[model samples]
Each structure stands twice: as C-alpha cells, then as structure tokens.
Target: MTKWSTIASSLSPDKMFLMKQAMEQLDTRYDEQESMVWGEEGQHDTRESAHYALGLLLRGSLEDVQMASGIIDRVLEMQLTQQGEIYEGTFRASPEQQAPPSGYTAWGTFSPGYGYAQQDALTEVYRRFAQYAQLEEQTQYKEQFGRAADEVFPRVWESFDPNWREFIACTFAVILENFEDRLSIKQVARMDKAMQRAVSTSLERYVSQSIPTNTNIELMHLFIAHYYGHRYEQIDWIQHAERGAMALLDDYRELHSFAEFNSSTYYGVDLTVLGMWRVYGRSVSFRNIGLQLEHGLWEDIAAFYSPAMENICGPFARSYENEITSHSSIGVLLYLALGESKRHLTSINCETSHDLLIALFGVDVPEAALQQLREQQGERFAVRQFKELCERDLPGHNRHVCTATAWLSPQLMIGGLTGSHNTNGQMHHATAHWLDEQGRRYSMRMVRREVGQSWNTHLRGMTFNVETEVSRLDITAHLEAAVPIELVFELEGAALHEIQITADRWQLPGLTVQVDAQAPQPQVIQQGGRAEIVYAVEHRDRIWNQMHFRLYFL
Candidate 1:
C-alpha cells in the first residue's frame, strides 16, 4: 500500500531524471486521435499503450493523468470479450488483430493468446491506476480500473505455458494483495479460485521435476511468487517457490553467473524482479538474498561492460538487440543507475517505459560496480566465466549436463556453450566482438546453413577453448550427418575496407581467422552493411566430419 507520492519522493536524483525523460518519450509517441501509441511496427500496440499509460500515471501530473485515462480506456476496449474462445479474456496485440491459429506457438505476433509475460504489465498498470484513482477520489477512473482487473483476473490461470505461468501468477498476487479491496465480492471470489488452480498446477508440475534455472528472469518471478505464497500461508506454494529459489541461488553460488548470461534485454527483467524482492519481500532472509543476488548481477554487468565500446562485450546466452546503442531496455536501466554521463550512450525511446518498475521501486547499484563502469577504459584485461545448464541425466532428475563459457578482453570478447547443438535462434554461440581501426564496432557470430533452408540457424556441434592470453579463440566443430554444411561468420557493422580474405587466411580490421580444414577460399556475401563470410567444409562432393579454426583478436 505504498503511495505514488512516497515512491516518487523516495526516488534518487538519477532515477527521478530518468523517469521524467522516459515519460516525455512515451508522451511523444501517443496518438491523440487513436488514444494509443503507434509501435515500431506502425500499428496501435495495446501493450505499449498500456505501458505508456502506466508511465503517465507514475508521472502524476494533471495532463499526464488525463492522457493515461484515455489510453487505459482504449486498451481495455481491445480485450477479447467473446466467451468460450481460446483468447476469451486476453488482450489483443493490436487493434485489428484476431486470435491465433489453434496450433500457434509464436508469442511475438499480434495474436490474442501469445502476449506471454508482456501482457502481465497491463495488470500492473491497472492496479497502479486504480490506486491513484482511489487516492485522488476519481470515482469514474476507480470503477474503470476495477472492471479492467475483473476482466483479466480469471484468465491469469488459463496459460498452460510454463515459461510464462509464474510471471502471470506473480502479477496476479500483486493485484490481489494491493487492489483486492476495490474489486466486487463476486470478482474477488472468482480471483481466489483462479489463483488456487494456478498454484496447484505449478506445485504439481515441480513435484516430479526440478525447477528451471536457465531463464534468469522467470526464475526471479518464481521467487517472488514464493514470497507471496508465504505471506498468504499457502504451504505448497511456499515450499515449491522456496525450493526453486534455493536451487537457483546455489547454482549462482557455484559459478557466479546465470545460465542466461549477459543479455541486454533480460538483464533488465532480472534486475527489476530482484528489486521487487529486495524492496517488498516479507521476510528478512528473502530481502537479504535479493540484495545479495542483485549486487552480484550488477558486478557481472560491470565486469563485461566496455566503456569505450559503450556496450556489454558478449557471448550472450540470449539477446534481443546486438548493439547497445539501439533502443534497449538495458540502456534505460544503465542510464538510471549511472546518471547523466551515460545519456549519450543511452537510447531513450518508447521502450524506456519498460523501466517503470525500477523507477517506482528504485535501484541500488553497488559502488564497486559503479567504479568499474566508470573507469574500465584503456586498461587491458580478460575474463572467463562458466555457467551451468539444467538437463536430465535420468528420469525425474536434473544435473549440470552442459556448461557455457564467456571470455572477455579489452578489445574483443568470444565464447559459447560446450554441448548446445540445437537452434533456439537466440544462442550467440562462437560469437566475437571487437572495435575496428576506425573505432567502429563489429560483431561476428557463427551460424549453420542446412541443405534446403534459406534462413541461417544457430545449430552447430561445436565447442571453444580460450587460450591463456584470451586474444586467441580455438573452435572445433563436428558434423553428425553427411549433409553438406557451411559454417558462416555473419559480420555486422563492418565496411568494405574493414575486411580482407586471402587464400590461406582471413583478416578483419580487428581480428584474424585461420582454418585448418582443406577447404576453398571463403565466400563473401554482402547485404548492405552486413556480410557473411562462408566457409564450406565439403571436399570432393563429401562434407568433412570435423573442422577446426582459430580466431586471433589481439
């Protein structure tokens, strides 16, 4: 029951400035006629409109609140109201979108049921606006907010996707804890039943399996749910969450890195959820653990962040955008914590609204992390980190079956997972990043091309070992099948003069590559600013089973 006024006043100067800037950015995106913001895809985005409304509500000015009310009303109208449909109670991604096909699993489209965790932000916006309406004695807005919550609450338990269940449940718990008083008695009863079902299903799933620790952000949401279950005296829910939390903590304690390591987008999610626990956990142990883990994560970010490049040097486990200078959620978080000096490096745009949680709760980045972020220029160094993956060795048991490595240096960063062979499409395996002679940054990552597939995939049976100097990266790849395969190096942000290829080796402005396989010269395919340096491992119409390459970035 914290008030917006209290939260606003409690924000540090840096966060306060960031919040105002984020609000301004969101406000500029608002389309007055449509009562929503046009997204990057040039459509009226329901989720982004809700995020914009939330930022406006947080701003709490007279005109800002009025604009927020309009957006909220429009977004609520976008929710599917047809009973008995697959997406009956869920919101649409866009104004004219329909429910997805019966077998659809892609969550990024304008489909009704694929909003995933992004839709959870709408529930938070409803709760916060409801609270504001009650405080300001705005009766119409209060009723509107209450009805919006009622419309969405029953659907929280409807998602069977394990990847997003905890995220939805965590937001549901927050709504129940904060906005339950505003709901009608019938609505509250329905919500309570839905929550029971949700918790029971979660408990049942984890009974025979270990909790997932690889996706770092959702792991934190599970911990947040555990805290709420303890607060509500739900024994099973509390135990399940506690088990997951301890397992995750123990995993981090072992290697001091998350399985989803060094992500620009998800790192913000990780930090936000951790901040939720740190600020609002019911128990001292929960609060302390949150603080400890948050500090450790900040340290890791600082260690890999290159001030000169203005980006986190990666071997990223998951990444939405390769360049940090683009519109990114992580850049907003960094700007808030690191202050004005980071403004030029930060890309503050509509996506900055993603930092609403951090703005409301506040951030506490450690001084040690801050010092490294501020001073880690012109000093040469190297870093190697190992992360454990959860995989099954036998039925109903999980072990550290795969390990991922990330090696970082002052000028270049390279590394990847040892046993990952499939393409989830986000794994940056065998990745390298360096600054060219003209100080322009470039990224090179290995991708596999199958026989008939036009799109490149991340699938590869490969492993890397970094030498002592960290400037040299050794890669060994094998082919499981006899299909002709080509290991392509996709280079982005390079110009014509920045690369050269010879019969024996390849040279980039910042790194050199040498292959030990008896293959022809590398083929260069250029598409605008991006190029793919393709190395085919086929000889005499038969693909080789194994090949080796070395990258020297010194």
Candidate 2:
C-alpha cells in the first residue's frame, strides 16, 4: 500500500486557504450581508451543505461526534419524503433572503478550494474512524467516529433534501464506495436493491437537472467522483460504458470535432463509465470506442492527445509503442478496446488520449511516424489550447474537462457529484460518482505544439512556467487568438492549478508568491502594458504556489 491514506489528507493546506478566501467572498450568517453583491443574503448552498462540512470538521476533533450528529439528526427529521426519495433541501430561506453573488457564484463558491478540500478531509477522518462502529475500538478516534456515525446515520437520510438529490446521490456513492472499501464482497453483494435504486435515481435526476443538484465549480466535483467507485455487477453498468463509447465514437465519426458531441455531456457518458465500467470492469463493448477514435475519426477529442504523441500513426498503425496511464472512464474504455483489438496507441504527444490510442492499436511505431503526427497537430491544436478562460487552482494546463468551462476546469475534480452550468448559465448540474477515492498528488499531461503568434489583433497566450528541483508544473500556450487577445497563464500554488486572466491590463493581478516567498508581487512582470497581476489563491500553505504567464499581444 502507498504509505498514505488518501482520505486523511484529501485537502492540502493550500486548498484549505483558498476555500477560506472563497468563503470570505460570501455573507455568512455571521455577517448581516445587508449590502451584499446580489443585494441579498447567504448563498443557496450554505444552508444544509454547511452542516455536512461542519459536522465533518467537528467530528474529527470533538470526542463526541454527537454534537454534529444531533444537528444532522435534526436535519434529517426535516425530510418528510419517504426513505428512498427527496424533494427539497433541508435548509430554506426566502429568495429575498438570498443574494446571488458579485462574481460567478458557482466559481466563487470554491473561493480557493477550501470547501472542496474540506469535504475530502472530513471524509478521510470519518472513514478511518467509521470502522469503530462496533463502538469497541476504544481509540479516541473510534469514540468520536462512533458518536458521529451513530447520531448521523440514523438521521442523515431524513435530513437529506429531495431537491438536493444530486448531493444525496453523492453521499450515497460515498457510502457505497466506503462500504466496499471496508466490507467484504459478500457484504457488498448483500446491499438491498433499494440502495442501488437510490443511486441510479439520483444520478438520473441529477443529469436531468430536474432539481437542485449543483453545488459549484463546473457543476462540482461529482463528475470526477462518479468514476472512481466500483462498477456495477448485478446491473449493466458495463453496457452503459460500451454504449457511451459507441455513441461518442459514432458522433465523432460524423462530426469533425468532439466539441460538437453535446449528447454525451447531458447523458453523462463519462459518469456512466465511472458508475458501470471503471470500478466494475465489465464494459467489454467500450474497448472499441478508443479504437475508432484512434482511427482518427474524431479530431476534436484526438486533439487533446492523439497525433501529438510519439506515435506517428493511429492505434491501428502500432500498439506496442503507446501506453495508457489514466484511470478515467475514457482511459478504461480505451484499454478495453486495445486489449480486445490488440492495437497500440502511442503518444503523438504526451496526452493520455494518444496513450489510449496506442493501447488500442498494440504496435511498435516508427519514430518518423510520431514526428509526422506532431507536424500535423498544428493550428487546430493551438486553438484548442487557446480557447480557455484560466483556472487558478489547477496546478497546470487542465482547465481540461470541458470546452465550456475552460479555465474553470481546475475547480473540477474527478467525480460526478460536481456538475457544471446549463446552457442558460445556471449552476444547475450536480452529479454523484460511483466510487470513493483517497490521495491527491496529481500530474496531468496533454500535447501542445506551440503555434506562434502573428499580428492577428488578438493574442492567444501568456507563459507561466515553474520547474523547481522539488516541484515541476507549467501552463504555457498554443495561441489561436481571435478578436480579444487574451494572455493565458498557468497558476499553481496550493495543491491544485487554475487559469488566470488580467481584465483591463491596467491592474495587473498580484499576490504574494507561495513557492519562493522572496518573490515579490506587483514587481513589474510587464504584460498587456501592465505591472504584476494577481490571481485567486486557494490556500496559503504549500508555500510553492506560483503563476507563470504566456503574454499575448495581438
């Protein structure tokens, strides 16, 4: 085992600080918030959501989890809905009492990622202690866990808001995933259908967005969370994975770019992969999708990695050279395809997508082939890299998941409980994942051929590079600048990374550098005819946070 329990340190110190910054953006109950941005009050998510977070914090420290548990029980008592369903949230305030927010509330909710890390922190602590449910493991931790679970377990279901079904699904996924982690297979097999029903129903409802599922960040971390849990056995989760792959493949074949395949977005194709295939490992059909995509049928998704890798040809051309490394839904499906088809997907560049293709093809490719592929990954790749807003939390270039969320991708984690806004721009999408994960030292790599800039009127990128002997991270550019030239940069400080933008260029966004404390801000890194510009800081710990920019002067 890896010496660390992921749950215990889910939230890095840096993340905790960012969350504090975000919370500060709001008008908490402690503040009257009379003159708030939306000219309103507390946010929509703070009511019952705070309790879960608060309970977790208190549960870890207080010998008696009872205080939090009692509060949880009281909340559950509010759930008039039946055992398996919810129709509303536990916390309620008039719309008049609620203020929307000054900036995008969805983005603001994360502040710097404290709220996000807090969840992981609480979860880790609780899971570690949960095993003491016998109330027998007399460690101080056990007593606290026992008290918390005892009080909360009985009443949590009641407190869950029906309208917040997405959150419910997220909670259920965790419960199930943790149960699997702690219980025997036989024990897991014994969970009644009612539980599954609850999960599926919640996910379906969440994807549909018929209710309030969103908590923040491109819908929230639930999207990534959905993928980590165990796959379905009694059900057809594998089939779902296969179908999603096929549909995406089919769409990519018809459409030149994956950016056009909006169906999978709503259907939660990635989510299904998590819920049914990755954990369960049953989706035999999905293996083919990677094969098809590798065949170069869909350029958009392929652009994320494919031709840029070392492999010159697609997976069909070679297999042995490419190696897939991701545990994501797409990665799992691609591996399935490669194993079935015996193809290899090598990196046209460093992206896992290219890795997926190589795994699918299964061949030893020529170095020349990879060189040729990179040569071809020109402007289209640059544009793909350029069309982003900038995420401050993502340690590197990911602002990845969506073309829509762009820079906000850093706020996204790998689960389904997190969702994004609808086309109408409402933060209505919330998801639930299929698994429970622990640990966070992450490294995400994608392919980019620096398409240089010209006098095109809009600058496509800015440079943000950092490579210390201890830490390695960067957010560079591949500009396909259009009307408004935006200097893109990579910002990493806390544990995560994000993208940052300087609005008018007059006021350079500046802040204290976390990595090299001696590094002064507003210290004249000229861009957009401005001084040092600052970005959103997620946490103050992890003293290595830095922002590297790629200036774009179109």
Candidate 3:
C-alpha cells in the first residue's frame, strides 16, 4: 500500500481527503453480520451490501478483505426460492414482510429487476474472490459459487432480456471470464453455449427495435460479442456497437457538452464499463477511443462537483432529485485515474467503485489527459463550469428543459422543471424541480386529469413543452378536460411569491396558467411563508397546449 505514492501524487489534497473519508465509511457501514445498512440504523439489503463489499475487497487492505468476505458469505447464505426461482432476500429476514428499518418510512420489496442485479453482484464478488483467496477458502468458495451460478445464471438468462440490462450483460461478461474451469468442465462448456445463444438472441432483438440507451451496456455487449466464437455475429454486433457509440458521442459533441441524462447514477455506469473496455478489450483503436471519452466525461462531471461543499451541486438538465448531490455520488475522477494509470491509489476511494483498480492495471491513457486530471480540484474549476452549464444545452428527449443556477459565492442552487422520462406510468401533469445548497429538494406535482377519468383518457398522450432560462423556468400542460385542476408543489424551504386569478388567466410571477372553455378562478393560500395555489377552470373539452404556466418560489 505504501508503494502507491505515484498514484497518491496524482490526486489533489481535497480528493485525497474525500477518498480517505469514503473508504473509512465503507469500513464502518457494514455490520458484524456483514449486512449493509443505508446508514447506522438503515435497512439492511443483501444486494447493496454485496456491491459495497465488491469494491472494498479490491482495496487490498486486510480489514477490507475480511469485511468483503463476510458480506459475500452472508449473501450466499441468504439466497431463497420463490416460485421455483432463486432470489436474494431484501434483508437478513424477509425484508418484504418485516417492518422498515428504524427511522425509515417503509420497507422494500424484491423485484425481478433488482433480483437479477443482486445475483450479478454475488457472481462478480465470487469471481474476484476466486482470483485472490487462499487455496482452501478459494476452492470452497468456488464450489459454492459454481452451484449458485448453475441455479441463478440460467434463470437470470431466461427471466430477463440482456438487451434491457447492462448490469446483467456486464455480469455475463464477467462470468465468461471467471467461471471457466472452476465449475465442472462439462457444465462450463454447456453453460457457455447457452449463455452465448442467449446473449446473441437478445442483442439481435434489441438492435432490431432501438439503439442502445446506455454506452456502458453497449460496451459490455460489444466485448462479449467480439470475443464470442460466433465469428459472424461477433463481427456484426461489433459494427453495431461501434455505430451506437459513434452516435452517442456525436449527440454529446453536437451539444458540445454532456447531459446527465435521466439519472445522475448512469454517469458511473458509463464510466465503469468504458473503463472495463479500455482495460480488457483486445483492440487498441477502440480502447483509445474509450480512453478519450473517459477523460472528457471526467472533466465534465467534476465541473459539477464542488469540493468546497463536497457535493455535485448541479445544473443538471435531468436527474433524479434525491441523487443530484448525494454523498455517495459517482467517483468519476477516481475511476478515471485508476483506468488511465492502472495504479490503485488509496486516494481514489469511492463507495460504489469495484475491481477496476485491480482489474484495469497497466491500461494506458494519454499523458496529456492524465496530467489534466492530476491538476484538478473542484471549486475553482467547477465555478468556471457553472458558467458553462448556464450557456450550454443539456438536452434529453426534449422532455426536460435546460437547467438554471445561481452561484452565490459559496452556495450553488440549481433548478429545472421536467416531465417523466419513462412513460410506463400514467401521465403526470407537471413536475417542478429545485435543489438547494444542502441538497434539499422541492418538487411540485399536479394530479393528472386522467384520475377517475375513463381509460380512454389515457389514450390522450401528453408531451413536455416546457422551457427554461437562467433566472426562470416554465411548464405547460394540455389535458382533455377544460375544467380547472389543482396543482400541488411539494416544498421544503420554498415560499409563495405572488398569485392572482381572473376570468381568463391564473397569474403567477412570469406567466399565466389558463384552461379553455371556462375562465379560471384561482385561489392562493399562504401559510408559514409557504403557499399552495388552487384554481378552477370552466368545464371544457380540453386543456390546450396554450395553458402556459410558471412556478413562483415564495
């Protein structure tokens, strides 16, 4: 560990401290049972804990190895069957049935998607353990891991489409790498054929329908496809992957900037897989492209990070508010530094990071880019990027408008009003988004006109025709009904500014909220500096697109 001075020298002092804090916390967050809680008294989930341990184990500290091994063992012990299929428990007990962990409002359920992810985590941990564990423990765990894979891998392959899950695709890639010879030779051969077929079928089906939404997932598919024995499919999928990567890069380049996309978390997913490709992919040209993209993304991502606050205080065009500035935000710079130099730096700790430190050793990166990373600290660089964020367009399906921020010396405030990115649920009218300095969020939602309305109302699709500027944000909605509706804004520390109503318009700060077929009679109530606005409109056949609205922060 002391030999890592070269790596340590690459990070600024602030990042070094953050890395220390992250790793120390990872040490404490696990219990004696090795269950990972969200906090000291948070709910214990086998899946989340496994992920944490996977990264910790790669830290190569004696204490980390012990903690990670304990977690992997406990996760192996918790696999249970429901409906003739194996799934890891959400807790040590039936977390689904048990009360929520202390201080939590509710418990969690085991979903097929999450179940697939947990199994992937276990297999990944086992893969790493097999490589580095002592002989006897290694053999024992290998046999246990093999049996788990035999049960879960087929089911996971059968139950989920690989195209939809990059996590599983990447997991499959790992299985291909690690499970050989450890399992019964005959079983390994058969499993390989089956997984190869499954991955191929899903890749074909997915490409036929749509381009890959995630770069990381596509890279996994490419890595597997390129090396798979099916030469024709290998070449075919590799071309497909290359095309997709080009398009994604083009999308960002056209904007001349990056959008956080729908979730801030995907940033990590992209970096991790790209880092994996650069490390493991056989082609030099592709690895170089990956390295370039990795460096560019790190620069952009770090620009949002404020070392002063140790948070990603964002002007993200689209992101889940809860994760906007989470303490456990993605470790882009940490991973990039590891990917570039292949030296594992203790100063590069991030809770969600995995075996890339060990796995990607000696992978080459451009000296210029590595030098740039070695020189960065957040606040000064981020302050400049704060200006860039305001000038640039971080577009996402046109569903979310641009972001606006106010940098008040030491504090940063970001806000954006957006509609749902996924259309699986009923159409929401409008969601007003705001994130204050402390990561406190304020979102306002209006119940859709579809509630209690006929299912045919759902046939009426909605679009987000919202717009934004540096100081203001606006949203508009068109409903099938002309009647006035109630809009609810969930507030933390926000207050009402001004509210008024007339026959034709409900007035706020910047614009009017209107519905056709009847004049809107709006009511404004202010309580404790916070306000709620309710208005009624005449019964009309539709709330046309012209019902422009602006949110007023009180």
Per-model TM values vs. the true structure: 0.71, 0.29, 0.49
Please give the lDDT score at residue 371 for candidate 2. Answer: 42
Q: Model 3, which residues run further than 4 Å from truth?
A: 1-165, 172-195, 210-216, 227-233, 257-262, 302-318, 325-328, 331-412, 415-460, 479-488, 492-547, 551-554
Q: Candidate 1, which segments miss by more than 4 Å at Cα?
A: 1-6, 28-38, 42-47, 61-213, 227-235, 326-328, 349-351, 377-409, 416-423, 449-469, 481-485, 494-498, 510-520, 536-540
In the range 320-427, model 2's lDDT, one tens digit per residue, is 111232212233233232332212321122122212111212322234433433443332211121112121222232222232111111111111101111112111
Q: Of 2 and 3, which scores higher on TM-score? A: 3
TM-score of 2: 0.29
Give the per-residue lDDT digits (tens) of candidate 3, residues 220-287: 56555554523335667667656655655665565334444323445555566676667656567667
| Residue runs of model 2 more than 4 Å from their true location after superposition | 1-3, 6-194, 200-245, 256-276, 287-553
lDDT of 1 by residue, 130-161 (tens): 56667554234645664554454322223322
Ranking by lDDT, best first? 1, 3, 2
